[model samples]
Target: MVRKHERLATAWAAGVAGVVFALLMAAVIVLVRVALPGGADGGDVTTDSGQRSAVRTALALLPFAGIAFLWFMGALREQAGEGEDRFVSTVFLGSGLIFVATLFAAAAAAGSVLGESPQSSDFGRRLTYTLLTTYAMRMAAVFIITTSTIGRRLGVLPRPLVVLGYLSGLALLVMGANVPWSELIFPVWALVLSLNILWGRRPASARPAAPA
Candidate 1:
């Protein structure tokens, strides 16, 4: 009974955290994209007060998003228990940490634009874009791919969802830097995965055995 309750709690934690992280991240991405539709080289974002406010809001929400993501990741890992592969788990953990670090770095870079001259603002904006689209999204892709692989190996995710994960990961890997708003894919994937957890769709083998 204790173990069953523990598993239920962990699942709920994973599902709730994932949903929170996804919603926060999606909002941040939308706010940032709307505020900076022209990308780094298109326009001077510092001149517009509205854009600056939007960017500030996005930056403010980023830390909370990162925190929720960490919780989601930890809870998902806990669900894997002793069956998790050491090598894949290492990649999963590394990618997640790197994604958060890069995300923070990008937010910092974006924040610097508010206090800088037009000349330096351009540099900061470019740096922010590079960190977010190129580095952070790449790490996100790796995390998604590794997670899907782990889920498949553990029989925790269905085949359709696994295929979707692979496709989403690949899209982010190849087109994330070039495509505007592509970062939303990560949050969408998280939302889907979280919903699956909440629905309790796992195979019987993946569940804890009853206390005899």
Candidate 2:
């Protein structure tokens, strides 16, 4: 009973961490979006204090978010245990790692814009855009798909959530880089998944019939 209680506590802790990861990452995206100008012209890059502050805050949050994500993954794996489908689990873990890597790459690309001359800001801005909206989102889509697939196979997720994951994954894969702010969906999905798990929506065991 004690071991089971500990496991449950760990699961809840992991769920909270996952939610934190989503929140921090979402905040970073929003802050960076607000700080950057709409026009792609490198000449428009401004090092104003507000934008700089936003970028700095975003940079500071990213490492914590990544660490939380790693913890979330480990906790989720513990929940799945040895019964999980090996192939799907492998893909899920791999895509998650790639997602974090590309996410950091995007942040670094954006950070590089800070020190550059206004003339060079355009190049950095475009690079950051491509890295984040294009590459990072693609990896996120793969992660979502694999996670949804695992959840479906394990019966650990509700049908509506699984369908929502597919839709979100499709948006990331198909409309990615083209749709502004589309990357928010990744964090939003993570929030939903974490909340659902934390709500004690575990797989049920078949109960034997009551005695007559």
Task: Provide the overall lDDT of each model, using Cα atoms, as 2-decimal numbers.
Answer: 0.92, 0.81
lDDT of 2 by residue, 121-193 (tens): 6676787778778888898898888888888988988999999999999999998766778889999999999
In candidate 2, position 86 carries an lDDT of: 88
Model 1, stretches more than 4 Å misplaced?
Answer: 201-212
What is the C-alpha lDDT profile of model 1 across 25-86, one tens digit per residue?
Answer: 99998988888787877588778999899999999999999999999999999998889999
Worst 10 residues of 2 by lDDT: 201-210
Best by lDDT: 1
Clashes of each: 0, 1
